[model samples]
Target: MKALKPRRFGWWYVAEWRLRGMRSYRWTILLMTLGNPVLYLAAMGIGLGALVRVDVAGVSYLHFVAPALLVSTTVAEGFNEASWPVMSGFRWQKFYLGMSATPLAPVQLAMGESVAVSLRLWVQSFTFWLIGLAFGAFDGLVSILIVPIAVGAAMATHAVVMAYVATIDNDVVMTFMYRMIMMPMFLFAGTFYPLETMPVFLQWIGWISPMWHGSQLARVVAIGLPEPGWLIACHVGFLAVWTIGGLLWARRTFTKRVVV
Candidate 1:
């Protein structure tokens, strides 16, 4: 194995490489990055929200949905980042293989990828939160809490998916995952509506979803939504477990694939 470089530079190299590749599509990325929050808030919050005309969760429909959307969007971004990019790194471009040849260990590569994804989630979540502020969806300064909550959701999802990707030989399963798994979680995990409104059988989906946990925490932090302290502990605990478990799995898989 090559001698490890300085730890900081090793991590920076991994993250910077990914960012440089992303720079090629900066215009498209910028457009979608800013445009999505505006359009979603306008269409779902204003247009559809007008017809409902009921204060949901003790707040306007827009406000209730805004934090949830921030969490959901970050979850979606995390999944997307983990899906095709992870596949490409292993199979198509074999970039992870190349990185393994250098001073970077498999664990370092994984951590670096995580750092890049986390930074992207931070920017995306903040952009959405800022737009929400302009729309008057956020309550006030406290609503800034959505960014960290959203990033937490992103990290949890990204870590789990990265581990899953490490074990798979092909990406065809990703399509099924997006359609059958992610879509259901997005639709039913307290994003568009509260979980109580959903039937009992469906509530379990949200219970297991990182998006729901993150969204609930966001609502509590953003607008002082009332929730039991134990439930809050559950949310935090579950996300933490997912992140830790997933990283452990990813480290094992990466070591098998790259180091050995």
Candidate 2:
């Protein structure tokens, strides 16, 4: 008799399923990945940049804002990937539960979802970067390096949001996250100006915000913004911890929900 083949989990297959579902909305994705950067860069980076009438941090206003927008777009896209789709899987579609009936474990499903979304984010970030380059918002090839840094920060945010979505029973909390949490961070996280320029009390908001950390890193790479080496290390470390911790929590939560 032939030896029995070991049953293996096929998480990448799950990711492929998710990607196929996303194909139905390819136009929306295309518009967003291509249009958003251009619209924002032209509006804020150029239009608002015109009124400033003074350089920011020794570079054109467009340059200073471009990287920040890149970070913001990446984070926003990351959060979005983890939000409604997650809820649909658990609450509406029950696709995760169905997957659990197979050899696919909950942790595998969680990782598969995360990977699919990360791939989407990668494409979006690439589009955003190319638009920035075309507009001359970035200085040189060195600015290309900021692309991965921004994506890493976005993935950190994505992981945390996924963990949160795993525990939620309704979309209400997700709404609050977008309106209260995401919007505030987007507005106040040193995206438009240096944190020091903000009121001292409000500056702390940026200190803890992932968007701020990512933007700081992007600014460092894109424009050579002066930052202490230690501070840079802290930025990278903070993002890394959040990414790892959040994914672990998500995996555990997903296991509990599906395997129970």
Each model's lDDT comes to 0.87, 0.88
Question: Which tens-of-lDDT digit does each residue in 72-148 have in candidate 2?
Answer: 88998888888999888998899888887877767778778878888888889888999999998988888987788
For 89-187, candidate 1 gives per-residue lDDT tens digits of 988899999988777878777777888889887998999999999999898888898899899988998999998898788768888899988999999
Candidate 2 backbone collisions, by pair:
none
Q: 45, model 1: CA deviation in Å?
A: 0.5
- Which residue ranges in model 2 land beyond 4 Å of their true spot? 1-9
The prediction achieving the highest lDDT against the true structure is: 2
Top TM-score hit? 1
| Lowest lDDT block of 10, candidate 1 | 1-10
Candidate 2 has its poorest 10 consecutive residues by lDDT at: 1-10
